[model samples]
Target: MKTIFFSFLFFGSLISAQNSLSFQAQLPSINLWTKIPDGPGPGGENIVSAKGSVTHVSIPKLIIHQPENPNGIAVLVISGGGYAHIESGSEGYPASEWLKSLGITAFELQYRLPEEGWATRSVPFQDAQRALRIIRKAAGKYKIDPNKIGVLGFSAGGHLAGYISSTFNTAYYKPQDDIDLISAQPNFTAMIYPVVSMLPPNNTTHSFKSLLGKDSDEKDQAKLSVEKQVNAQTPVTFLAQSEDDPISPVENSILMYQALKDHKIPAELHLFQSGGHGWGMGKKGTNTGEWTDLFLKWLKVNGIYNSDQ
Candidate 1:
């Protein structure tokens, strides 16, 4: 029963913007089972997304970036770390900055990484559910349209966003408060080169091992394969993946798109020729740098973003 209080993050003018709703983080009121077979031994930064990324995480926090001119659109942005750490600087703040420039409010959620002694397979989702519930309850303060709330996740986080969007109806924990009554469902979801399946061959072994142990049964893995979990009510999805992504196969996005298409769910897929994997908003010359523009256009096309709001 350890509790950790959150510390507010101030990134100064370079990373700060207007009209944000950064909530104070609290320890996990509800604990999910965990299997941390490997201990955190002298954790440090690992170069990822062309930036120094933290390698271990425990508590969850929200760092919001509101647009200078809000369009009543908000996206909860989740960073990817293969369930090992959070690329908060490269994947979290940078994305929020770009979204803010688009007049779309962005909430960067720092969720607990699996296999970190704080969570099991369901822990990340529980934290996501709680984060969304808080946003939905305080929608007005953030000046967002609750129904227009969406999720954008990078890599493993992308998998999480898609997984939560489809499985929002399943309750894995008891409600905590009035805010818990709010649904965690996203109106739209975006997965950027995500590890979408728990099944091997197409998915990353580390992420599945972190969430579900190496000894987990086939049925459990099948249950978490997001492509097979989509239903008629699943939200519209936007996927972006590099054809040559070394870590996560392009087939993950393809399988998810096919599932959405078969279920008649609105979906969009982008497969770049290069860009490799985990380029975080791209590294200049890469064509993946243009993904933000395409995402904005998609949002506008879906009427999720409007200048008039």
Candidate 2:
């Protein structure tokens, strides 16, 4: 029974919008079934890459980015690291910065890696669900609409976002407090080149192995294949992937979009000709750079964002 305490992150690079890291705190009172796992995983104990990704995480934290003119919209941004690490540097921070500029309050989630060692497969899922409820519980404090909360994830994180978006009704963990009473569901979801499936050739082996472990059964994998889990209550979704994505096949996004449509949920998909994958917010001359603009428009069209607000 090891308890984790809050340790605020104050790095300028990790903060979005001119040092606007309004809040960076651990999800309060997490009750994992077992003690939190310490890292000695792929990149060695808690070593962060030059690219800003950390190879190990014992405690998950939520970094808040407040917009200069908040339009009552919020997004929980999850970065991808193939379930091996947390890609806060590339995927998380940059996306939060962009979201902040657009007046959308962003919360960057640094979640635990299952492969690093956790008692259960649902550890990261629990972190995400708790993070959303925490935000919703304090919706008035952030001056954002609770019902407008959405999630945006990249790569493996996209799989996580898709997971919670579709299966939020499932209780992955016991309630810690009144915050747990708030809905963990996202109003919308945006998955960028995500690893959506856990079955067959389309599944990314690294993510599958990290999530379900090497000796995982077919039944367990089938249950986590997000496309197979979509129901009538799945949130409106937006998916973007490069046609030539080498890691997560483009079919991942396609399958998710089809599931959403099958359930009569509003959905959108964008396929780029180039840009091989993990392009984060994209650089100068890539088609993936245009995804943010497209996403903003979709949010507005879906009534999740209001320029007037």
Which TM-score value belongs to model 1? 0.82
**Predicted candidate 2 versus true structure: per-residue lDDT over 1-309, tens digit per residue:** 011000112232444333222223322223322423333323433445665676666656677778777888889999998888777766787687678877888888878788665667677898898888877877898889988999999999999999999889898887766777889999999999999999987655578988877776778889989999999889999999999999999999999998888889999999999889887876334577777778888998998877675
* Model 1 accuracy (lDDT, Cα): 0.72
Say which candidate scores most in TM-score. 2
Task: For each candidate in the order shown, give its overall lDDT on alpha carbons.
Answer: 0.72, 0.78
lDDT of 1 by residue, 204-269 (tens): 546777788767777888898889899998999999999998888888999999999999999999
Question: In model 1, where do residues sit more than 4 Å from their true spots?
Answer: 1-52, 307-309
Q: Please, what is the TM-score per model?
A: 0.82, 0.85
Tell me the alpha-carbon RMSD of every candidate: 8.5, 7.7
Clashing residue pairs for model 1: none
